[model samples]
Target: MYTISDYLLDLLNYLNVKDVLGVPGDYNLSFLDHITRRSDMKWRGNMNELNAAYMADGYARQNGMAVLVTTFGVGELSAVNGLSGSQAEKVPVLEIVGTPTLAAQYDQKLIHHSLGDGNFEHFQNVHKELGFKVEAITKDDAISEINQVVKYVYENKQPGYLALPVDLTEMPVNPIFKQLIPSLFRNKNEPHDHLQNIEAISNQLKNSHHPILIIGEDVQRFHLQDVVRNFIINNDIPFADMIESKGIIDETLPQFIGTYNGSLSKDLTNQLINKSDLILLLGAILTDANTGGFTQSFNSQNTIDINAKRINFYSKIINYNEQNGFVNLIKIISQTSLSQSFPKGPHDSINNKLPVPSDKPITQDFYTSAMSNFIQSDDTVIAEQGTSLFALEQIKFPANVKFICQPLWSSIGFSFPATLGSQLANPKRRNVLSIGEGSLLMTIQEMGFAVKYDLKPIIFVIDNHGYSVERVIHGMHEPYNDVPALNYSLIPEAFGAKKNQYNYFDVRTEKELLMAMKSIENNSSQLSIVRVSMAASDAPEDLKEFGKIIAKQNKG
Candidate 1:
């Protein structure tokens, strides 16, 4: 009596996907039933699809591939922001779409959020355009397609698809279905025992007067923490990260520098890295946000880029290179007889480090420091776009802890829903959310999902009115820049949270915030929202300059 729904559960279980973030509807009810009836997979309900997708992304970033399930039309459209972001950031995601039965899909009748002109292929089209491998399911193809879709997305580190046909839910299982196994493919970047480019890199590291290493999420994606740390410690190379990639090394290491996410080594760090004769980059993408649009004083000296694909050392820009496995290069670098005496920052004697909190209004450095102390060693941090990004850049976490954000897309509304995934993935791990007020309102309904699961997190709502980041960039000081905000504390009530279980803290003054934060230590685990207030005058110092540049570029 086993059906496609049962096989689907088995597929999810095989991927170790115990949690799914999504909304259930008529089209997807059979799948939902399977989730409810089965013991292997657990469901974290969401009020909308966007939140579901984001939660899935957050969970995937931490635990593994996240399962995001949704119904057709409105449900599919609702999740576009998060799914597209996962695609942009190279997160492996398993997105399951529940389509109308094979017959009603192209009906000319007006349906909500559907491309009613009979283009039922819109969902698949959107997925393809966004770089996700899509599969439109028919009753006949259900077994084979589901198996293949899961395998491709799992191994490729990309978003993938499964468009389910409702009719397949009730179809009788065939004995031949057991033969549908996942297809395996090997990566071109696989490592070997020895490599020439790696040997050259080893030589460079050995000869260099000062060499620093930069890494990003790619290290985590490739699971090279041990290799990265060993290389750094063995070579005595100073290292820094691009916000989300912090904590790859033991922060206690003397050579471990603070974040370079937006700071861009500007005053001291820029000079240190740029002035270096040799720089080894391990799994860093060097995006505009991390390098401040690559305007690190316009250095002409070549940087050695050692990513998963290639290894290259250069006098200026990319020079001698090999497009092979960085793992092998790292191994070669680790064994090399490199000098251990690397130069330190000129300001190493100074107290200038990542911003520690003060008894003042919220600043990125201060906020992150406080948050770092607030969360336990294993707590998960789910971040959204804007000033929160700056805060995440400042706090250092343990190697096992994770910070999830939709950086590639940098979309709002992710932090709120992503918490659902984090909670579902590891029930014991504390989940904390960092999001701006504008971002929270985008998918505020997802808060109900939190209450439903009783998944508690201290959600810090950075309440600075509307679109703070955009305002900082554009300098559009008009009424349009402000958002219509409600009482931030009332959100929990509106989201169906019970009074006894919900906690609200409005932090306007420093003293109040300190008190609220202290109270958090006593609450075992509660979904508390601490609203942080900011003045219009407050912004990142570099952000003001960015706004001026935008104004100058627009000048007539």
Candidate 2:
């Protein structure tokens, strides 16, 4: 009685996917029934395919892997935006599109979701451009194709798309229990080669008087926290992160310097980073956002940048083949001893403490500091790509926490849907989302899914009456940058929240915000949403600088 659908669910379960995020479509109804009825996989229906894809992305980031199922054509196209964000962020999400039957395809019949031109492979070809390993699955190679796709996703930390035909759902297939290792990473399991390169790096660190390290997002992707922590603590090297990799290292550590966003960093941070003798840049994603619009300055000759697949030491580029990767490189770097010590940032500095509440309106400065205290250890903080992210850069997170954002992709409404995925991935942890009103307007429907599932995530909606980020970048007084005023506190109720299930607050002043924070603390078991109103003209200093830089670049 076992079917291919059952086998597919089993494989997903093997990959530690307990729930699937997607919307049900008629084309995929048969497979949806199998998922909804199955005990191994729980189906969480989203309001739309885009939100489903974003939720799956958030889940993948937290759980290491995730799945998104959608109907072919329209559903698949709608979910592509989310999948593209995941692909850009290097998250592993398996995208399954339940397509028309093989018979329909063979006969070149026009389907409801098709283009009517009798071309079945057009969508798959379109997906190929988005960095997805796309495959149109058939009965004969279904199991093998699934296995291969899953492995590619896990090993490469990228999205994979599979167009699953409806007719193959009932076909019996053996569930492969093989691990999904990266097929393209030939050097993943290989031993270290070029001991000379290791020697050169070790000697460089040992001889340097002030060798500093820079941590980045790949450390979290590769799960190298312990190795990174030990390397920093054992060698007494000061470390800083690019904005995208904010919480990759233990921020509470004494040796942890603040994040560097090129010229956007504070004066002290910029000085220290630029003055480094030997800079060991590990797992960095050097995007314009991460580099503060390409303003970050480092001596190329003094920098040794090591990523998952390659090493850039000085002017030389050594690619990882069947010999070396981060595994071997990290080992060599960890064992090396520095000859001299570098001055670390103040260890006893409690500069980021929350401010005492007053009757004044809640400014971005005050809100950032207050939130530092509101956030607890082990909480996952998700910020939208604008003012929320820029303000949070000033706060120092506690231990065992996560910070999720799409700085490079710059998606506006990603945080709200991502919160659902993050909470589902780590149900026990407290999940908090910080997003502006404009961004929230895009994916607010996903809140209904949260209420239906009884999931709790503290959400902060910064109400500035419009697109605050856009206004700063350009068109400060323009109508296009202004969003309709929303009563954000009513969102949960509108989304069908039960009585006392969620605590809602609307705070315009510092005193009100402080009271709201206390209320949220007391109602930890319930979902909470706080709406804080700020001046439409106000923005973080760093954001203003970024806007100017971006505006200037656009003009040139």
Candidate 3:
């Protein structure tokens, strides 16, 4: 007769989980001890539970399956913030919460730190807001319950949960669970009139000019990137992505029009999409923020949406499952195709050409060059928000290169630990992150993880001061983005980074930037933070009119 904890271990193996991200405390020591000894599952070290959750979110976004573990109360709550961020972004994360063992949960007297009745009702109920499936695991139901949880999270593309009481962590395996095998399918929720909407969308596409296409993160989840890219290329439509939709096309493609959201250009793309008689929005949801609150930017004759859910658009709502309701529409477009005017290879179009390297003082183009010069085609790109966002928007990704950016939530300080997880996920791939100095301090301790394991990634800190996005939008733009610049070169020595394994440099001009980058090549096991100055500037177009109207109304 195996104990409950042992059965839980077997269940994790069944689900093929290789690592769990979280921190260990006294409450979870036994459980951590059990998993730590097992070769099959390893613990991803975390400096903070919040970053751990973000790391799990990134890992989920990357590997499609991410599991996070944390202690009860504060630990679990620390992780909820990131979990919520993940849920909002539609990333799937499995949160394994360690509860106070049943043997000690009854607080006969005042406990060291109990948030509630020790039942963790608040903890479990929090998922209702987070929109993820939550379950409390008992010693007896370890295998069956855990298996079911894993299957649901995988199918739904949302976070999953397993609340572990300390007692269950060390319990033996369940004999009955050994016979259980979980199915990976999710319960389908069909829209009321899905097929009719598809028919209507087909009617719209059949009568159009300049019919462009877009595929979002959902396509990536379905492993349909190749399918969608082929369809777009065959149709010869210039394409763009929501932040999460990077890599759907070779971003380097001539026909690929980059992302179409905050900080992304709305110039030619906005004009083309608005001018298009038909827009086929496949896998892309019409989120207000993504579409500037679905404002006047959309002037197309018809907007046909294909998504995981039936979304109302152009008086028609379409919901399709794996092209089940979409085949009829595809066939119609397959017949009246006119994309042959577009070429197969990359762009020769002058408007779409990469911006010429300019000496223009303080532009995203400047930092993009600094990064591109250092970034080997073989290296992976891990981007953070703010100036890093600006820099990467223009950087062309290389072959065998994967770019990691948390653009969905665009949460600050996101790239630090996420880079750590990326390194762990693919050891051979080098890590590089561009972060705002203020954002980096949110969880600067994560750099310690690099020190502990000596997992070196070249870190470029865009020391553009505090909250660049906020200042530009609301308050004074300049002086506001300014924060004290620390000599980041001492980071290696301060963090116990391997001796001679790291270097630090600051760059404000063209020559110094080039020299610093040249020094980093062939370096190993090092943390290099290249500090780039931040000069305040306006967004592509200020929303002053929009902001003014709202403010005036609020005052009224």
Q: Write the per-residue lDDT of candidate 1 for residues 1-556, one digit (tens) a residue.
A: 8787787777677767888778887888887887888777777677778877888887887776888889887788778777888877777888888887777765655565567676678778887888788887666676778777877677656788788877777676765554443323334654464465656667777777777777777677756788778877776788776655756665547776655644434456666766677666777766666666445432325467765544445633332233334444565566766646877653231222434335677664455556666655676777787777655655556545667766557787777777777777777887778888888888887777778888888888888777777887774577777878788777788878889887889887666666788887788577788898866556555545544544565673
Encode model 3's per-residue lDDT on 1-556: one tens digit a residue. Answer: 4666666666656655677788887667777776778788887778889989887876766677788888877888888888877776667788888777666765533344466455546768887666778878875665667777777677667788788877766566647665554432333544433455545555665555566676666676655666666666676667776655655556665677546653334455556555666666776766643554345355433666665554546755434544233433343333444523532233222222333443444445555655655665556677776556645654445543566766557678778888777776566777777777878877788777777766777787766556665554456456655556666767667777766666778776656666677777756556677776656553213233333333445465
Least lDDT summed over 10 consecutive residues: which range in candidate 1? Answer: 346-355
Clashes of 2: 0
Model 2 weakest 10-residue run by lDDT:
176-185
Better of 1 and 3 by lDDT: 1
lDDT of 2 by residue, 1-556 (tens): 7777787777777778999989887777888888888787798999999999899989988999999899989999999999999888889999999999899999999879899988898899889987699877777787778777877787778899987888888887543432332333344456667577889988988887777788888888877878888888887889887777877888888888788888888777777787888888888878888778999788588899888768898969988764336766786678776657778665322245666789999999888888888888899999998899998875678887898999988889999999999999989989989999999999999989999999999999999989988998899999999888876667788889977898988998999999998988887899888998999988888898999999999899
| Model 1 stretches with alpha carbons more than 4 Å out | 103-114, 138-144, 171-194, 262-266, 297-301, 308-340, 345-369, 372-376, 396-401, 545-556
lDDT of 3 at 161: 75
Candidate 1 collision pairs: 55-418, 265-270, 302-315, 302-316, 302-317
Report, for all candidates in order, the number of backbone clashes: 5, 0, 10
What TM-score does each of the candidates earn?
0.86, 0.95, 0.83
lDDT of 3 at 403: 68
Instruction: Name the runs in model 2 displaced over 4 angstroms.
Output: 175-189, 347-351
* Colliding pairs, model 3: 2-172, 2-173, 3-171, 3-172, 3-173, 4-171, 4-172, 5-171, 7-173, 288-293
Candidate 3 ranges beyond 4 A from true positions: 1-16, 103-110, 116-119, 175-207, 262-266, 292-296, 299-301, 311-313, 318-363, 372-379, 394-401, 477-484, 522-525, 536-556
